[model samples]
Target: MVLQRMGSVKVASATLVAALAVVFALTLMKGTYSFGGFWSTEAHRNRSIDLQLFDAWSNPTLWYAPWLDAVGNVALFIPFGFLLVTIVAGRWRIPIVFSTLLGFLVSVGIEVAQYVYAIGYTDVDDVVCNTVGAFLGACFARILGYRGRGFVVTLFLVGALCVLAEMVLSVVF
Candidate 1:
């Protein structure tokens, strides 16, 4: 029994790390990186931020862009929350609190990086969507109880799909 529990923790931790890697890769390295260019005057001119919540949805010319961004941002963090709950499974309150805080912090970190690196827009909507997604995932995990390896495997599958989607989008656009 102890061995099984240990194994579950290991699997959850590994899945969490992989999920986070995917998040960073998709967030930080989405666009081609050019450090010198980022520091150049021309590159810095394009940097943008939207502090107002849900501002992305108001784009008149690009109605679908905001929806896609919101869904993708939320989906990206779901697995993180699920795996986090699994890692600390059996505890009711700790898992929820841990996942929520960690997920929010992670989202904020990514947003800050996006601004500093100028790789993408720094939108408050993304943070809100991500935190909500994480919280939802944690709730699901708590409700479903610890399914152990199954959840980890599912997370991997989801991560793969996300990566594939990203690749296709990059190639197409």
Candidate 2:
């Protein structure tokens, strides 16, 4: 019975990871999947990379766009970090560090892809924010005792169901 339950959890975790990967890809591509060719590469080649740190503090504005963007970037990776840590809980000696590094690499890859595809500009600030978010998520997962396979499976199911419901509702309404 225990072996059967573990197998089920593994299956669920794999499914959740696949779903997360799809979502991440769609998000990084801005929901526009293409196979013909990369669009507007030359036009965006001259775009300047912004390495400025603490942009919100450097230019304090009432609009709050920068702040919101920073927060959004962080929020975007939290679930990814949480899920990653939960999936690799028992196997990894330092799951939090692994999660943070994974987040950094993913963020870097996205930034590079954006620059290459001309879909968006690259920013170091985003990498920092995303890493922090992943770290926080890993910490949260540890606090919640997600080392157990049962808890991880339950969490994934609940999250997946919620996301599905949200998508359905958005389409219906």
lDDT per model vs. reference: 0.73, 0.65
lDDT per residue as tens, model 2, 8-119:
5365467457546644543354424331232332333443467887666676655675776678778767766776776787889999999999989988887777676665
**TM-score of every candidate:** 0.77, 0.67
**Candidate 1 wrongly placed segments (more than 4 Å):** 1-7, 33-46, 148-152, 155-158, 161-173
- Clashes by residue pair, model 2: none
lDDT, residue 164, model 2? 54
lDDT of 1 at 65: 68
| Candidate 2 lDDT | 0.65
- In model 2, what is the error at residue 39, expressed in angstroms? 19
Q: Measured by TM-score, how close is model 1 to the native structure?
A: 0.77
